[model samples]
Target: MRNLLMKVSYDGTDYNGFQTQPGGHTIQDYLEEAIRRLSGEQLKITASGRTDAGVHARAQVFNFYTASPIPVERWCMALNTWLPEDIVVSDAMEVPMEFHSRHAAKRKTYRFTINANQYPDLFNRRYQIHHHGKLDIAAMRQGLSHLIGTHDFTTFASRKSTKPSHVRTIFDAWIEKDTSTCRPGTRDQGIIHTFISGNGFLQHMVRIIMGTLIEVGEGKRQPDDMKVILEAQNRAAAGPTAMGKGLMLWEVDYDIASQEKHND
Candidate 1:
């Protein structure tokens, strides 16, 4: 058997997330089905992580072992032929037998988009969270600063998680606004995009972070209080978890050896 790594991109609007569910459609279900049909082999695939419903991914990684002799490019084409339009295989290649997509991943970056404006644009509504209230950008930035570095993020994760450890090193966390458009259209309205890059993330961690930052921006919470919340280690102390629609798995970074193994 040969190990294959796939770089997948999906719009998570309709599915029940990345993982396979018994009765629900998912990005994984369709992906595995396509692989089965194309390779004529049953394979179990593993992803870097699970993304909740309505959350999109730009470059999610997964790996599977197959005995088929299909070319790497053919794997991409064959899978796309069976997969839905929202999910596409951007790249696929054989990897070293020891390479595991989840274990080999070095870091992940996520982007949460907020439509900080009075009106939402219809075209981009599905991908961003729309809020009309005036937000204090300075306070939001201050709140996010506290989240950088290593911390036990139990307060920010969902109760459904079963991970043994909540300690994660956030290499970077910051918020930025796109004010490029000087135009006065609804589409040109400024947006606050939160970028979080870390060694790993717990379930709902990013969403809760976004929610708490939003509260800080709205003057509902003090930026300095984030340290207290982090120390509390209780989910209730954190702000409401933001909707999953606005979160996107922006990128997955891996070692060069892993990349070469996949390409080979």
Candidate 2:
């Protein structure tokens, strides 16, 4: 069986989530259906991770094993023809059989956006959370800085997660103010973008952290509270979960050196 790695981008507003489950349509279900149609094989694709409902992805990665003779380069165009407009297969390549998507992922980066405007930006409303309250970006940056480094992130993870460990290493975290070049009336006063990159994330970890940072930006929590929350290791000590619409799987990083060695 030849293993193929593919990058997919999707607008997750209509789907339940990336994973297939009862009673809801999903990204995986559509991909599987398209695969079965093209190759007439009932095969499963393994994703780097799952995004929650309404959470979009720019470069989500996945891998699948297939015996079909279709060239790897054609996979992207082939799959895109079958997928909905909101979902697109961007790239594809053959990989070593042992290269599992989730296990081989080196890091993943997520971006959460907040529309800090009294009047929302009509064009980007679906992709960002509208927050009327004035946000202190400086304070938010301070709070986000504390998230860098290794820590037990139980306070930020969802209780629904079945993972045994909440200890993850955060490589980087930062905030940025978006300066929109849209038409005069279409753009909002400001857009706050929060980015976090980590070795791995727990369920709802990015959203929860974004929520806590928003609280800090609102002056509801001190910037130093981030350290306290991390030490607490209790979910109750953190802020509420942010809306999934504002979170997107921005990118996934892989160890190319390791994969190349294996291929060699």
lDDT against the true structure, each candidate: 0.90, 0.90
How would you encode candidate 1's per-residue C-alpha lDDT over 1-264 as one tens digit per residue? 788899999999999999987867999998999988887877779999989999999999999988888887788988999999999999988778888888988999999999887777689888899988878989989989998999999999899989999999999988889876325755344788999999999999999999998999889999999888998999999999999999999999889575675767
Please write out the lDDT profile of model 2 over residues 80-191, one tens digit for every residue.
Answer: 8888999999989988889899999999999999988777778988789988877888988988888899999999999888889999999999887866632466434478
| Candidate 2 global lDDT | 0.90
RMSD of 2: 2.0
Weakest ten-residue segment in model 1 by summed lDDT: 180-189
Candidate 2 weakest ten by summed lDDT: 180-189
State in Å the error of residue 200, model 2: 0.5
**Measured by TM-score, how close is model 2 to the native structure?**
0.95
lDDT of model 1, residue 239: 95
